[model samples]
Target: MESRRRTFLRIATLELCERFGFYGLQSVSVLYFVRTMGLSEQGAIMLWGAFSALMFGVPVLGGWLGDRMLGARRTVAVALALLATGYTGLASGMGGAAGVSLVLAVLVCGGGIFKPNITSLLRHAFSDGDDRLDIVFTIYYMSINVGATIAALAIPFLAVHIGWQASFGVSAAVLWIGFAVSLTLPATAPPPAGGGDRRLWLLLGAGIGVAFTLLHYPALAKICIWIAAAAIVLIWIVLYRRAAPIWRAGLKLSFALQAEAILFFLFNQQIATSLTGFARDHLAGTIRLAGVDWAVQPGQFQSLNNLWIVIFAPCLAALYYHAERKGRPISVPIRFLFGFVLLTASFVLWRAAALAGAAGPISPWWMVAGYALFSLGELLIAALGLAVIARYAPPDGVGRLMGCFSVFGGLASYLGSLVATYGMAGSGTASTAGYTHLFGNLAALSAIVALASALFIPFARKMDAHWRHAIPRPSSTDKTPTEILP
Candidate 1:
């Protein structure tokens, strides 16, 4: 196989631009829902949480289509078009209607398709497996930051001036470009699909699905409750063990990283969701600094995280690579633990910044500092997840495995919304004590997650070592004859 595909750079740049558009809107979505759309705290958080989760969730459906029927290119075109439409519609400030909610959901569905397949295509571009996988993901992650940085700089400024619609329109245009560029890239030979008899596979799939329904349907909650209980009681992840040792280990490590990444995304809702209240209650004055003016708005601060992501991602990636060159054990899960710990530190610092702001209008720089801290965490955890998923998945299961990671992302966002709700109740400028209390809880939670991850690392490393040989096998379904793809 040639070292790399000719089209890799083309795909990465376009995808990065695409990311900018999505995050541009996403960064400011909470603010839009509350301020312009007239949503309450409860309404905003729930919708935002659902939007975040569902956005990740829809990809499962998209992956099903991509792997089973539509193929990557077609699925991507359809999904990106849908995402573009969703952003444009949202830019209309039509967010107040039921149609808008459905539109948002459609965006979620579109994401399921567009997001995963882009990375899938990128990896598929290269003939090698896991060799350059980290770099591949890092490249993709960098694209996400490209958009993030641009969106960060633009959306808040746009939202402050022409309103959400115009800001959203800018994103819509970027998406189109992404779509056009993706189409222009060279195509690959679709790997011959390998599996058992189609008829038998279908029957088994249907039968098991039916059996699952029969087992879990009458009371869905009860089924999940028992499943969780079983996993906990067994002292090991039950459903997971059936997977081969390497995959099981890598997946565990991936989950730990994902848990950290998803939590960051979940907490990210606050920047857009609660910023209006935060700025309104605190911050002394606002003036026109850069053609746009917010008399007093914390929402402008949302851009700081993206800004830092844009500036620091390349640097951090280099640092990681540099460390790797020096024979460091910068394994994926270890990176996740550090990210989690840093995130905890960010909240702690945010509280201190809030306290210091009491004496005067806190420099928007404080939020920037906090965002910088979080963005560092993002680089380590969230950024690495997609690549990890691609590199480690059993060949036939790429889409499904990515879909699983997406589900975890959604679950984390959903849970984060709940956590954010409680934090917001006491997080504004209205009460100093409430604000202090808020960050304290956040720090505590971060600490706990970090601790859990540290404990999980040795196990992750052990599993990774054990499963080293089994990666990227051509067919997971061929039980007796394992054909490893290296």
Candidate 2:
């Protein structure tokens, strides 16, 4: 138990630093494109969508490399190095818009490589049946938010005061710090078992080439995304058909949960795009809290999402742990249903605020309130997403499945960006009415998803039961697996 705890902390710390750098970049990315690069709001959003899609879409390859080639630890090391390099390039402001886009491609490649493998390593550190997995992942989720919250708050402030270059440089420095921390990971953590240095070099070269090509030809993003989406579906079908009968139920459950996750991410993507824009244009810049009026930048408002997560993650973790200890743990399906409901309420709240502020800027408090609910919803869904794969995916294929999960999320992100484009103000000045319409449509969509989730509860419960029953249990006399390393 002590060893597992240590492993968890090390991995979580690494993730925290990576997230700090990544979210810092995200906090200012769209704004940089619009303000620094002189792109229109719509163009910035579209480019962001393309970047996000590729960022997540590449994880499928990363997962394969981690699982079948370079190993998770080595892949992560390479990814961190790539990320640092890309951020440094951005900080230098070398080639203008084209240069930034090229560096973004590098960042996308780095993110794709890092995202899946680190979580897979954590999942491998524990026994599959351990009830603590949910609690562990929930805390892991909080670690990510901790980094994100700080970056979201600080990076944008730096961008406003110092310069965009300085803020990006900070991100580069943070990633280098993460790389240093990665070296301290315990030897017990998974090590490279397959593929040689040759394979690693080849993959790195191929990834960069593909990322650069996709970025240069933005139109290819939509086509590639659709093709990737179809490919994932086909792969899932093949996996389902080939899986053992006992594994089929779990796969079905995983597929359903993953589909739900895709929908949730569509809403999640708005945080750095539409929500940030809304905050910048129509929302009050100052928020009152406990008799203090605090000024916040539009980008800084993105921190509210992570801030709420930091405050509530521990509470949710405790609730989950206690419930499991009491042998009355909340079911995933129920959690997902509640998540969608909260998401619906969040959009509704935002919609109301947009309408109320049609004449002028609304109180930032509306954002705070909406983000609280939205963050909780994210905790229940996005945070647990990996837990679902860990709990339900076939052990041998968890890495690949994790990658597939990210692919779904990437597709959803692109779709969400498209959705946000509709809300973009055609002129220089953004109107509250555009946001009002967007939020209203989002509210309707979330409500429909919530209803669908509620309706699927019974079926999902049956799937859960079959999966639990199908799992093999060790006898009381048998020792726990030592693969996790003590």
Candidate 3:
């Protein structure tokens, strides 16, 4: 078990590194489109929405392949290959929108295969009923934020310094690195309960990784992510969960989980949506420290959010870990409350920035303040929820459930874009009024989120209890086929 833990850490390092590489490429995509692609601010929001949705939406398909067809190992490698191709096309500027759209679509789908599979692989490292879950999830959360931190710093600088296409090239490079790592991994990675080791296949996979990195064919990449994704889908069919009498409780959890996930997803898109715009438009001239440069771009402020995550994820993880140990306060519902509260505060920062913009450049600290608050909110609900979700859902269908988790975020992003479009479209040019309408609407949404959450507390507080009652507890007379006790 200790050896497996060590190996899991190694894999986590590589996986997080991959995440950093990918998000670094993604974080500044909106800025690239707005400044480079000549998209309207709102149009950029829409693009962001589409991008986010596709990135998330593809996971259902990806998981299908990972579980049913290709398995995690092949699915991840092939997805990486496709990702590399998409970036190659993006960097070389080899095609028109149609071509690029196809490339983007393929890349998005590839993400579906890659993202969830990678996450699922990490999660599976902790077995059913493992007591170390909270700690393990915290460690996993750190990697997520660490990747985000890198993305926040790297992508914006790359985009600002080079062309958008070149910025995209970096994404390809990251995925290639991930592919290199993936190939070397022992097939026992999601470790077979009982199995044999095959080093030759690992080396062969490495060669393929090198070859594709050398190749700049988006077409090939798309084909690869697609095939890998397709393979996983077929595999999923093979592993599809069978119905059982106890599944009713699990199904109820799934429905609530879907709703819960969507709300958090909406919460996350703020980074790409209003948050980015707020930083860029309002903070270029403010936020100076004696030794630090305030000349940093708006997008750069996002780095602070990820940085705080590094500081906070482990702390929050520890808090919950201890709470669980003592049988005291920690649980999903309470954590979710914090999420709503923090998100509300994030909007307050946006509101403050809007109010202050009339004076001069809104203080960059305001941006940091908002992001920090938002990140805090996310940690409580958005971040920890991923771990909780795996816990609450049926183990047999975990990937598909996670896929829904990813989709919830996409749906929220899509809604945000739609809201932003309609919220801003009817107004005049991007003036104070335009900003007002946008910020004002976001504020309202944030408030509603808070209120909705507060209302849910009474119901959610009873969830674990309700769930316990809803299912049978193990005892002498009631020996179940599986162990699913709290």
Candidate 4:
């Protein structure tokens, strides 16, 4: 157990570094689009959304490669290297909009590959149905927030003081360090004993080729996303059909939770895109603390959610631990409902801030409060989301299912981006009325979902109880399963 903990720490540390690099670039990316590239608020938000979609969308392919060909550790290492290269290009600043787009596209692919495989590796390191997984993932997510907070605080300051290019350069350097660390980590999962068939390789190659081509054409890319998404749903349906009766109920619940997750991210994703626009247009230029004037940029405020996470994660984890020890543990559906309620509150707070700003540029404190709710929601939902995936996925399909889990984020990003684009369409600037209406609508949607999830909690609990009874518990001496991906 000590050895496992140490190995997990090593993997989590590397993940922290990778996230530092990823968020460093992401924190300031929308600002780059708006200020450096001279794009409209709508254009920047849409582009950010598209970039986010690709980041989440490519994971299924990455998971397939990791499980079938490269192995998890190998896949992660390759992705880190690619991310380094992409950040380096962004830092060089030689690229116009087109060049930046191409660089970001490469990053999207690398990020997609990196994200799921890391989660898969962590799951692989532990035994199936391990009780410690929840704590492990919570700690893991805390590391992510730690890295993200630092990036969010630093990148915007660097971009504003030095330049956007310099900020990106810092990210590139961090990613390279993570890549170096990755090279030394022990392999968690081995590839199949025999090499996969030639046809599988051909299919992967063809898929990559298609993705590359469509990236240049946004319309085609969106179409491809829908088509691929449909295919994924079909695959899920087939899996459900093939599952035995006991497994079928579990699978159904998994799909239900996943569908709910999409809704969660739909509202949660605004922090990267529309939220930035709101902060930029509405918040005061500076925050006065202890009679000291600190200028606040929209990019810098992106850290608020991470900051909140860092502050609250340990507390929340301890709360969960205490609850379970008391024999009154919180169930998944209850947690899901908590997350939705907090998320809904976040939008409501934002709506109130927008209304308040009609009189003057609102205080950044409003955004801070909103992000506090958002952060808690993220902890309840996204962190637990990983455990849910590991719990429900077949040992053989962990990587693939984790990849599919990322699809929820991808779909949310695409929908959020489209909504942000159309919602603020023809509104040249971020007007008070526009923000009020936007946030009002979002709040209402979140409220609806929260109530629905609450209503379904009883059903979910019943399903989960049956599912738990159906699975065989592992003994200490049992060998952990090695998934062989076809």
Candidate 5:
């Protein structure tokens, strides 16, 4: 148990460094596209959306590589190298627009390979049905936010004071540092039984082909994303059919929860696009705290999401831990409903702020308050998303299912970006009305999701019971399963 705990910590450290680089780049990416790349605001938003979509969308292939060809550790090592290379390319600024696009292509490929496998590697340290999985994953989630919060605060500052290229260079440096740290960690999973080298070469070839396609064919890339999404669905159907009868209920529930998670990601996308735009166009640059006014960069507002997550994640994790100790732990489905409720309130709060500040800039406090709710909702839904897969997904194919989760999220992210684009007012136009309408629409959607979650509770509980009974207890010493509500 102590060794497993140590393994989790080391893996979490790797996650922290990876997120530091990833979110650092994301913090300044849109503005970099607008200010440095000479793209229009809308174009920048769409480009960011596309980049996000691909970052998530490619994980299906990555998960397959980890599950079937390369082991989790090897896959992650390769991904870290690719990510560092991509960030270095961005820092170099070699080819202008084309150069940046090519670098983005590298990032998408690297990110796709990195995201799912790392999480799978972390989960590999624990046995199936370990009661501590929820708390462990929640803490793991917080590690990600910890990295994001620091990067969010620091990278934007660097972008503003130094140069954009310099900020990206920092991201590259962080990843290389992570790669160095990774060497000391023991392998948590073994390589495949055979053909690992042959398959590694094949995946490398395929990755290069993918990068070339993304660099040269923008429209084709979009089409490929949709095609990949369709393939993911088809694969899910196949997996469901092939799963043992006892495992089918859990897999179905996992799929349902992941689908619902898509809505949360839609709202999540606003932090990068519309919300950042709002901060730049409407809010004051400096926020007043206790006694002093502190200046803030618009990009730094993105940090609020991570900051709030860092503040609240441990609290929620403790609550879950205590509840489980009493054998009345809060279920993931109930948490999902609560998440949507908070998300609804967040959008409503933002809408009220937009309306109240009709005459002039609003208080940055409003952004702070809105993000508090938004981040809590994120903790409930997004943070526990992997927990859902971990608890319910078949042990044999959990890695692939994790990738499917990313695919659903990527699709939602792209759709959310489209939604944000509609709320974007033209360069010289008043944005208040548009933002108000957008927030109002989001609030309504969130309410509808909340209601659906409530309706689905009974079904989810039934599925939970089915899964609990179907799987044998791992050992005599394993803790009893928490009681599910009738």
Candidate 6:
């Protein structure tokens, strides 16, 4: 038990450090681009969407490389080095749109590699059927929130007080520290996918460049994302056709759910994009709490999701614990269904806030309420999604499937960018009616997604049953197996 706990701590610490550095740059990115690079609101959002797409999208290849080639530890070290270099480069003021885009490409590529590999490593660290998995993940989730909360609070303030470059430099230094710490940890037993060659490396290089180029042009990026999503569906279809009869249903259902997962992220991303702009443009400068005035900055509102997560995660864990003890624990699909419901409620709350703002700048509490609801949904869906994928994915290709799952996040960013751009169309100049239209549309979209997810729950439950009984469990003593792959 002590050994397992130590392993968990090591993995959790690595995750925390990575998120801290990543969010430090991301928390203030919109403002930095707008103020320093002279980007329009829409332009900035689109760029962010592109950056997000790569961060999630590239994981597909990264997972392949990690699981099949270099092992997770080596992959992590290489990724962190790339991340630190990108941060340092940007701190030196990568000039203009093209230059900055290039630097971000490198940064996001590192994240793509780091994200899925670490997750795969963590999943592999435990024996199958370990009841402690959820609790461990809950703590892991909290670690992420801890890092994100600190970055959200500190980076924005630092950017304002000192300089934007200094904030990036700080992020770079922190990433280097994470890299150093990672080396001291116990090594993971590598999985059996290892087959990368020179050609694969060259193709990966090309893919990164293409991703950067597309992101540099938002219109092109949007079009390309749709194309990529379609291509992914086509690939899944081909795989399903060739798959063993027993595995087809699971594949079909998993793919459908992953595709639908995009909708959740579509709504989720407004926190960073549209919500930031909304807080900056519409909220009162100061909020009054208990007869004391508090200054509020729009960037600070970005931290609210993390803040809510820290507060709500333990409550969620307790709920799950009690439920599991009673033999009525929540299933993955049920969790997703509940998540969609909460997402709809969150948007409705935001719409109400937008309506209240028509008279004048509204209180920050409105946003607080909305984010709290959304954060609950995040805990239900996003935090649990990784575990779900790990559970359902074929034992031989867990990392690859997880990578594919991350693609939905990319698609969501693309779609969410469109929504955010529409939401902030007129920004400082839009009339009350314009804001009303924006929030109403978002609310309607959220409701539709929730309804759709509800309809799929029955099917998901059935698929869940089929998968659990079908996949062969590894022997208790066999911690790693190569035969599962080929």
Which candidate comes out best when scored by TM-score? 2
User: What's each prediction's TM-score?
Assistant: 0.74, 0.88, 0.78, 0.86, 0.87, 0.86
**Which ranges of candidate 6 are over 4 A from the true structure?**
1-10, 123-135, 188-208, 383-400, 423-432, 458-486
TM-score of 4: 0.86
> What 10-residue stretch in candidate 4 is worst by lDDT?
477-486
**Model 1, C-alpha of 218: deviation from truth (Å):** 22
Candidate 5 on 407-462: residue-level lDDT in tens? Answer: 77887887787788776656722388888998999999999999999999999988
Stretches off by above 4 angstroms in model 3 are 1-10, 35-38, 123-137, 188-254, 383-402, 422-429, 461-466, 476-486
Q: List pairs with backbone clashes in candidate 1.
A: 20-147, 59-112, 91-165, 246-467, 286-295
Q: What is the C-alpha RMSD of each candidate to the true structure, in Å?
A: 7.8, 4.3, 7.4, 4.9, 3.5, 4.8
Write down the lDDT that model 4 would get. Answer: 0.77
lDDT of 3 by residue, 1-486 (tens): 786687577667666756765576557766655564555666666666666666766667666667655667767777777677777777777553344455665566566678767866666566575787766776776777777777777777777788677877877777678777777654523423322225424533443343333223433533444454455445434433453445544455445544664676665666766666666665565456997765675566667878877777777768866776776745555566667778777776677677778676766777777777877777777644456456556567675656655655665676666565543543212444456666666667767766766676565545555656666577878645321223
Q: Each candidate: what lDDT? A: 0.63, 0.82, 0.62, 0.77, 0.81, 0.75
Total clashing pairs in model 1: 5
Which of 4 and 5 is ahead in lDDT? 5
Give the TM-score (vs. native) of candidate 2.
0.88
For 332-420, candidate 1 gives per-residue lDDT tens digits of 66777898888888888878866875676655555667778887877677656666656555565555555555666666666666565
Sum up the clashes in candidate 6. Answer: 2
Among residues 3 or more apart in sequence or in different chains, the pairs in candidate 4 whose N, CA or C atoms overlap within 3 Å are none
Question: Which of candidates 3 and 5 is the stronger one according to lDDT?
Answer: 5
Candidate topping lDDT = 2
Clashing pairs in 2: none
> In candidate 3, how many Å is residue 182 off?
1.3
